[model samples]
Target: MSTALKSIRSIAPLLDRVLVQRIKAETKTAGGIFLPESAVKELNEAKVLAVGPGGFNKDGQRMEPSVKPGDKVLVPQYGGSPIKVGEEEYSLFRDHELLAKINE
Candidate 1:
């Protein structure tokens, strides 16, 4: 984790909420050509930074989170509240808001 992320420890996620940072879009092409800012598309991929313990069920049982910190996950194109910390950008999403986890 980067230094900027270290500060995120102070902002803990409550219930099933999760903190994530979106993966940056590639600015270069396979042929080594550089793409302008407007040419790059924002990816819907993000890295899980922090996760809440679990949400309580109807019976009061804790429900485990489907994803954890350090996991790369797919997020929806819309939704999620944008958060800006220093020069980095982050988002808050419910555990169920995540689409899927990426392996490798």
Candidate 2:
């Protein structure tokens, strides 16, 4: 594992929390044109780095998290607590906060 990945793995999320790193926005256009950084839009996509064991239900039953590590998830444009490990940026979000899981 890389030093950055190792550093990120050091974090163990607890209880319905998920650790994720945002997928960087594309700087180049499909037409072979390069766009300025200011013109690039931030994407809501992210990769799951780590996941909590899951939260408890109303009846005290453990509800497993919907997503697992390595899953590509779609997050909201806002929300989530930002975290930093080494030179990489990560975010912590409740399982419910995740919008959708990207199959591709």
Candidate 3:
């Protein structure tokens, strides 16, 4: 983790809320061509930072979250609460708000 991210470790999500940072869009092509800022598309992928202890199920049993810190996941194009920590921005979402986990 980068030094900036180390500061984020102090924050812990509560009750099934997940904290994530979006993966940065590539600014350069594989062939070494630099792309304009407008040409970079925002990716829907994000890295999980912190996760809350699981939420309670209808039966009152605690259910564990499916994803853990360092896991890359697919997020929705919208929704999720935005958070700003220092100069960096992050997003907070419910466990279910995450679409899928990326293995690569």
> Which tens-of-lDDT digit does each residue in 1-104 have in candidate 1?
23355466687888999999999988999998999989999999999999998789999999999999999999999998777776778898989999999999
The whole-model lDDT of each prediction reads 0.88, 0.90, 0.90
Q: How big is the positional error of residue 54 in model 2, measured in Å on the Cα after superposition? A: 0.3
Quick one: how many clashes does candidate 1 have?
0
Could you tell me every candidate's TM-score relative to the true structure?
0.87, 0.88, 0.89
Off by over 4 Å in 2: 1-6
lDDT of 2 by residue, 1-104 (tens): 12445567788999999999999987899997999989888889999999999999999998999999999999999999888666778899999999999997
lDDT for position 49 in model 1? 93
3-75 per-residue lDDT for model 3 (tens digits): 3454777889998899999999989999989999999988999999999998899999988999999999999
Most lDDT-accurate candidate? 2
Which is the better candidate, 2 or 3, if ranked by TM-score?
3
RMSD of each: 3.5, 3.5, 3.7
Stretches of candidate 3 exceeding 4 Å from the true structure: 1-6
